[model samples]
Target chain A: MALRGRDIVSIRDLSTEEITEILDHARSMIPVAEGKKSSSALEGKVVATAFFEPSTRTRLSFEAAVQRLGGRCLTIADIGVTSMRKGESLYDTVRMLSSYSDAIVLRHPNEGAARLAADASDRPVINAGDGSNQHPTQALLDLMAMHETFGTLAGLKVVLLGDLKYGRTVHSLAIALAQFGSELVLSAPRALALPEDLRGELESLGAKISDEPELRRAVRDADVLYVTRIQKERFPDEGEYRSVAGSYRVDASVLDGAKPQLIVLHPLPRAGEVDPEVDRTPHAAYFRQAFLAVPVRMALLSSILAPTRGG
Target chain B: MVRELRITPIRNGTVIDHIANGLALDVLRIIGVRDLDKDSTVSIALHVRSGKIGWKDIVKVENMELSPRKVNAIALISPSATISIIRDHQVREKRAVDLPEHVTGVVRCPNINCISNQGEPIESDFRVVRRRPVVLRCAYCDRQVTDFLRHLA
Candidate 1:
């Protein structure tokens, strides 16, 4: 049952019970994450943030989590300035970092790079994001946000809106939610819908996923409405991207018919997918979701680095 | 009078029999045609009628025995296939090819973005998700792979 020295490369790596344990640990860290209380759970520990890819929230939140838990952070915020620019392999770099750090938080442009890093490092490795492959912590925090709002993870109707095809967060979160017995509804444009293979996998996992073409319609009975931007960079054809760019915007107006208990979430740095006006609504939990990153990451850091102390 | 097509058996080598019909060539591809010693004789029987299975294919190679990995690759393509080792023109050992729980380096992941395809210093690892259809999931990135032929490593 111990997660000490374990890697969080993908949500699939953690079972439902382990995910719940992490979420429960995150709940207890909220006060400390907010600086209202303090503890030295990660005292004398060093967590490294190695980012070969550009990221804002994930890297910052992980660093912030380490510091809040009374641990120091070694950050490689840019690859262009590091030995990676000299063609150093991820294996060599992580192996060197593991010598100085107790845990490593890695974000890389290559998919599955974290797993390779984990193999190279003796210390625990956490995948911040790996090129459309996985961001397990984001899925964990998303789960934490949902649990905090609803007090449960099972049997909730969740509508996944926007770019399901290229949105890594939605893909990982969808799989995690399915494992927890959540009923999923997909609300995305035809071209940007969830891949058939992933849909088949979810269906095989006994998850009931329904397709609703309209976001407004899909949110009618959903307990959670998770939205993602249609990434323009992922589209090879600019014209095709333009056609679906504004297809599914979630404004306050769209929430008119949604259930009062329905909460809206987005993995942010959004580009017109969620309206600014929607941020003021009570249903807007994306900010809370973003803020939950600290405590959730703190929980993860403690689980991997301080498991013996039950921090 | 109708006559059965016959090819001479080798004195010592291996016989891969009961491959699903029309898959004998794939078995050869898995075993690598160029890898076989040019001096040894190899025979392929395609779409051969069989009593146990309606139609089957068999491949016999002289002075060549398949490794467990190659045999596993053959199993992925043809689950019902059996491998027989011959010594002194006698069948020494015969057993069905068994697909191991973890398949390594046999096939490349179809995911272009998969780390296994990124020239990393590790062979591709797959978990056997389904045996009947032979579904493989990449151990690194969690991508499922079902199409095995074109992506053979």
Candidate 2:
């Protein structure tokens, strides 16, 4: 269960206790994150960031996490400049990256790219995001935020709204929350409903699930409403994307019937999923959700890079 | 004690009996019958009724003993198929094929952008997650595969 030298390819690879351990470490890193104090957990360690896909938030959070931990980082983005454009396979790139760093953080358009990288590399592989399959680190930070709000991850009435099918964060968070015994409410159009096999699996895990197509109806009794953007990039048809574009907007008016203590979280870079006016509400925790990524990621980097005593 | 057989039994080979009624040809494709030796005798019976499954198909291959990989593929397409290995006109080892926990190289991950599908040197591997619906999760992409016929590797 020790995260040291492990590949974080999926949230399923982590146990509930291991997840909580990382969160606890992240909480302790909050002071270091705010520059109130500093930790040299990765003073001499090197971490590599090889993002094959375009990103703003995830890449920045990882680079900042490495820097905060006093580790040297080498970033190579394949979106513009890399051998990946020259038809170099993920294995080749990952093999090369492993030679240069103690740990590698990877993001690819392919769903299982991190697993591929981890299988080939001796160094620890951290998945930033992989297609629409999983984002374990994101789920960890999201849980940390949930733990901050509710003081525990168990038994919260969690409503996951927006594009359930294509949102990687939604998939990982839903499964991880199920492992924590959260009551799950899924609200999405039929086109984007939770995959049935996954739903069946979650139900078998003793997590109660309810189908609520209307976002307002879904969040009325929610303790935590985790929203995700309906990614236009995932849909091939423009008209189909247009049809579901504004289907689940969360404004102050929409939250009128919601529980007063209900906290709303979103993996940011929202494309009109939440109203700007709602950003001023007490329920808006997306910004703090984003801020928590720094310390959480710092904890992850430190865990993987820190050397054990007796060496 | 026996009379003349309707179809002559093979001396040695595999007899796959009670295949789900219309999937004989599909099973042939999976086992690569076209690539078998020219001298081998292969017989297929379709729309056959049986006391067990009521409607079934049977395939008999002379001079070919199917590997575990082929048998595993048979389990996916026809969960109730029984593989009977005949030696010297006697049923030597007869057992019903059951799906293994992990199956590899049987079918491809349907996700087009899956790492297993990107011309990599990765053989498709699936973890048999559910049996009733025959759900398979790609070992690489975590994509659930239900349409097995479409994504046969």
Candidate 3:
């Protein structure tokens, strides 16, 4: 199917077949991104990334993806440094950015901000991250990583660790994971546990979900460990982040009794959660996970820009 | 049908039947119908046992046309409510009620910190995002307004 000029605001918008198509396209683009092959599909297309919030992986991965596809990127990293600080609304910023680029990737601290921007912009608006709401692209990339590691999601045992309450990535990923029959182990501090209604929804979708207090018990026999940082910025109080930060940490010693092929993943910007010593171990697939984002995003961009016939 | 037959007939007025008991006042409040005189025949039957549904209430207002807004408010209060609009001893309309898409100036967001709840004279606006579970997100605050604790305008 073609993906030209489509706004990827939520993973809920993609069916299982479309997600598989994106993964397939991403897998095909891996060789080209590694310099094994050459393709200039997005030659003259200009992609604009508007980050109103703090980001490193998402921004850089998008930039890399656009560049790898032979396209240019116009990035705005800080909202304060831009005209937004001088009394500009998000709608105005989107309208102005849309005129300059073929597609706009927006990351904002407000919930439903992407939808508002999408409504305003003539160009396609992809939601990079919205305030504790969704990060569709991250979910897509995580699915790609999981598919590459586990072969299929039919009966995979996946554990999502840390800050489920505030982590937009996990929320989006969990929603997407529900489409596939994946048993989930949600490990989080009591204060940062996943919302009850969402958990119920997942359970309704035939996902065998269990909440565990400790990270070790959650990841001991799990096929995948998806770790997220305790987002301090999302909390209105600093004490909340402080209280829940130490309870969930994955290190070399923690994985001593775990499965040999256990894939540990973290949506980066680590703050003493996962020990650096674990980076050398074959279990640490977070870096590869981060690198995997490029090709996935490339496929996403290509699908959005130059879709196949009858797509 | 037996529950409807239990309620006494009104000559020329609206009958809001099949409302859940103890919710009639809330329904009245939501529809902004508080100025009825004490002498006026405003009959309210509450906690009346009914077959199948266990218990329900019926309110018969004397000489009043049940507005669409009032019907919608009744629907929000009790989803299974039936509104019978009467005119000159004739049943004009009798059917199930439903709230409109853009419900303005009624049912304030319960969040105290919400802009609509700050007494700024702003209309309490909501769009029905999800119909099955009846999820209403505030137009101003974007907070999910559930059924249990909605503030009437």
| Candidate closest to the true structure, highest TM-score | 1
lDDT assessment of candidate 2: 0.89
- Candidate 2, residue B20: how far the Cα is off, in Å: 3.2
Judged by DockQ relative to the true structure, which candidate is superior, 1 or 3? 1
Tell me the spans in candidate 2 whose CA falls farther than 4 Å from its real position. Answer: B1-4, B47-55, B86-95
Over B4-34, each residue of candidate 2 has an lDDT whose tens digit, in order, gives 5656789999999999999999888887888
Question: Which of candidates 2 and 3 reaches a greater DockQ?
Answer: 2
- Tens digit of lDDT per residue, candidate 2, span A100-130? 9999999998889988899889999999999
How does each model score on TM-score?
0.95, 0.93, 0.83
Taking the tens digit of each residue's C-alpha lDDT, what string does model 3 give over A1-311? Answer: 45678888878778888999999999999997787888898889999999989889999999988998899999999887888788777777788999999999999876667766777789988999887777999999998888999889777889999899878899889988888888899888889889775686678777888887777787788999898988889887888777876776788988988899999888888898899999999999999889898999999988888845763
Two-chain DockQ for each candidate model: 0.62, 0.72, 0.15
Model 3 iRMSD vs. native = 6.4
List residue ranges in candidate 3 displaced over 4 A: A81-83, A307-311, B1-15, B33-55, B58-73, B86-89, B99-145, B151-153
Q: What is the lDDT of residue A293 in candidate 3?
A: 89
Clashing pairs for model 3 are A1-A311, A2-A311
- Candidate 2 residue B101 Cα shift, in angstroms, is 1.9
Backbone clashes for every candidate come to 0, 0, 2
Q: How does candidate 1 fare on TM-score?
A: 0.95
Q: Output the worst ten-in-a-row residue range by lDDT, candidate 1 chain B.
A: B112-121
Answer with 2 or 3, whichever has the higher TM-score. 2
Evaluate model 3: give its lDDT.
0.80
